[model samples]
Target: MPGLTFEKLLLIAIIAVFVLGPEKLPHYAAQLARLVKSLKNMASGAKDRLRDEMGPEFNDVDWQKLDPRQYDPRRIIREALLDDEGAAAPVAVKPPTRSRPVESAAQKRLGLAEAGAAAPFDSEAT
Candidate 1:
């Protein structure tokens, strides 16, 4: 990384220009690019060969599901909590219980006895 600074880069360009000359500098640069590409391919191939020799144990990787960019801490926490508490129960689709309709005065009186629940309605009957 340090070797690829602007000054080093300029120096390399100047040297390449001087050594290869202006006429052939472009050609040599293209050759250098091709060499770098081939070297990269060779290095990667070597890594694969090493892994192959090391057997399936070395290459026992799950590459499909792995990607650093997809990491999500909140999702992980939610999943862990759900698992810890056993699989989450299915959400109830029903509406919340509403106030029960008062039938007779006796039922209304009984409901009122329960306290703070249902207040007695002052209807014509009352």
Candidate 2:
């Protein structure tokens, strides 16, 4: 029912008319109808076969109960953050990193300040 529309039927008819010509178009159209019917019957048969194979377990499936669009990221993140904050155990707090010692002007001027020290001033006189 979903796929059966007037436009689609018209398109199929046009294609059939083109490929089968006006003379044999009726025969080919009949064959096409029979093929479509057989396909539908095969699909229905497969569904019934699958249900039978699944046995009594098939009845337990609640297809309408699942709604995949219910996920909420904000709620999940809020709950996780709250849970971490509310934990009873005292978490080890990392000590504030010792502030990097400021280099004196003398040390900065001299290249011997540190092994990886960058030359602060550009000196083109080599």
Q: What would the TM-scores of all predictions be?
A: 0.40, 0.42
lDDT of 2 by residue, 1-126 (tens): 577899998998898788879999888778879999999999999989989999988889887655655557898787887789657865899966756765677787685467557666767865
Tens digits of per-residue lDDT for model 1, 16-103: 8888889998888899999999999999999899888888776686666688767799998977877886676778899667485435
lDDT of each: 0.78, 0.80
**Candidate 2: TM-score?**
0.42
**Cα RMSD for candidates in order:** 20.0, 13.6
User: Candidate 1 regions off by >4 Å?
Assistant: 59-126
Identify the candidate with maximal TM-score. Answer: 2
Clashes (N, CA, C under 3 Å) per candidate: 0, 0
The local lDDT score (0 to 100) that residue 70 gets in candidate 1 is: 78
Model 2 stretches astray by more than 4 angstroms: 1-5, 64-126
